[model samples]
Target: MTLRHAVLAALLDGDMSGYQLAKTFDVSVSNYWHALPQQLYGELTKLEKEGLITGRVVIQQGRPNKRLFSLADPGTETLTQFITEPSRPSFIRDDLLVKVRACEVGGHAELIEQLEERAVQARAKITLFDKLLRELRGGTDEETYLASNSRIGPYLTGLRGRAFETETLLWCEQSARVLRLRIGSKPANG
Candidate 1:
């Protein structure tokens, strides 16, 4: 999906300034779709120009005025249309996977180290997602929250991210173990 759709999804929560939206994306949307702050700001302008979203300037004391954006009727309609269309299949284009493939060309040790580091990163993401899940739950039990929350899209996407990271951690650990075993058993010089 385009960043446009992601930004629309974010606005569903409520109207927010570009800064606020960027911060929200970092904590929430960054899990499923990564976009830099600059990219989000750019998209906000595009969306405004397209009339899909509306922005209003808010003055703040001792601070520059900021524009807050909210999804317009057209935006909601566009998002509905987008949801109906079949999504193209997703694929990984990861450098780490390329390195894994190249291990046979002589970087086994380095590759293994990289895999371990990736596992750590994955674990950190999982922890952050867990915290987000808790906040979304807001003291409500999972079943209650699922049944009651008007905006469940974020929660659903968050769950997907958590699962993805969890699986990534498992895969990295398994790959590292296999590589270590192979390296350990190999002849000293062959």
Candidate 2:
């Protein structure tokens, strides 16, 4: 998807400054997609010029003036069109996977180490996803927003993120076990 769509979908929750959008991505959307703050600022400008998003400058005492942005009608239309269109087939282009395949004949140990490190990263992200899911579940003392967002794209995206991370953690553990077996080490669990 284009950065335009990413930014627009992000703004679907409501208006936000660029800083707020960056933080939102870090907390929610950073798992499947990523954009630098500079990229976000640039995209916001382009989106505004295209009439997809509009921003209002807000003054703050301790910080630079922030431009709070929200979707215009055109932005919503664009997002609707983008979402309704059929998605392209997914493809894998992971350089690390390719590297591991090539190195399998030379020294699987290094590949094992790389994959193990990836496991750590994936596990950490899974913890974040779990937190997001719990947050999605809402609170007894506070209102939950995700229920209201059931029809929104991020609602579905959150499910997909959970599934993907679960598969990643499973694959990591299994791959590590298989590599250990190859090296004449007992399975980590066995």
Candidate 3:
């Protein structure tokens, strides 16, 4: 999906300034889609120009005024249309994976180190997703939250992110171990 759809999805929570949107993306939306602050700002402007979203200036006492954006009626309609369309499957395009494929050519040690680091990063993301899951539940038990909350989409997506990261961590660890063993079995000069 385009960043436009992602922004619209994020605005579903509430109106927010560019800065607020960036923070939300970093914490929540980053789980599924990643975008830089500048990209978000640009998309905000484009969305406003397209009438997909509306922005209003909010004045602060000591800080510069900021424009808060919210999804417009047209934007909601657009999102609904997008939902009805079949989604394209996502594929991995990772550099590390490519390097791993070439591990037999040497640099296995470096690749293994990179994989370990990725595992650590994945674990950190899992922790963050767990915290978000708790916050989304709002002190309600999982069953109650699932039964009561009408807007469970974010929660479900968060769960997917958590699961994906957990699996990634496991894969990274396994890859590192295999690479290490292969390196150990190799001759010193070979």
lDDT of each: 0.90, 0.79, 0.91
Candidate 1 lDDT by residue in tens digits, 1-190: 9999999989999999999998999887887789999999999999999999999999999999989999999999999999999999988778998888878888888788888899989999999999999999999988999999988888898899999999999999888888989888432222
Clashing pairs in 2: none
Root mean square deviation (Cα) for candidate 3: 3.6
Which residue ranges in model 3 land beyond 4 Å of their true spot?
185-190
Ten-residue region with minimum lDDT total, candidate 3: 181-190
Cα miss at 119, model 1 (Å)?
Answer: 0.9
Q: RMSD of each candidate?
A: 3.8, 3.3, 3.6
TM-scores for candidates 1 onward, in order: 0.93, 0.86, 0.94
Residues forming the 10-long window of minimal summed lDDT in candidate 1 = 181-190
What would the per-residue lDDT of candidate 3 be over residues 1-190, giving only the tens digit for each residue? 9999999999999899999999999988987799999999999999999999999999999999989999999999999999999999988888998998888898877788789899989999999999999999988987899899989988999999999999999999889888878777432223
**Reference-based lDDT, residue 87, model 2:** 94
Candidate 2, poorest ten consecutive residues by summed lDDT: 140-149
lDDT of 3 at 179: 82
Best by lDDT: 3
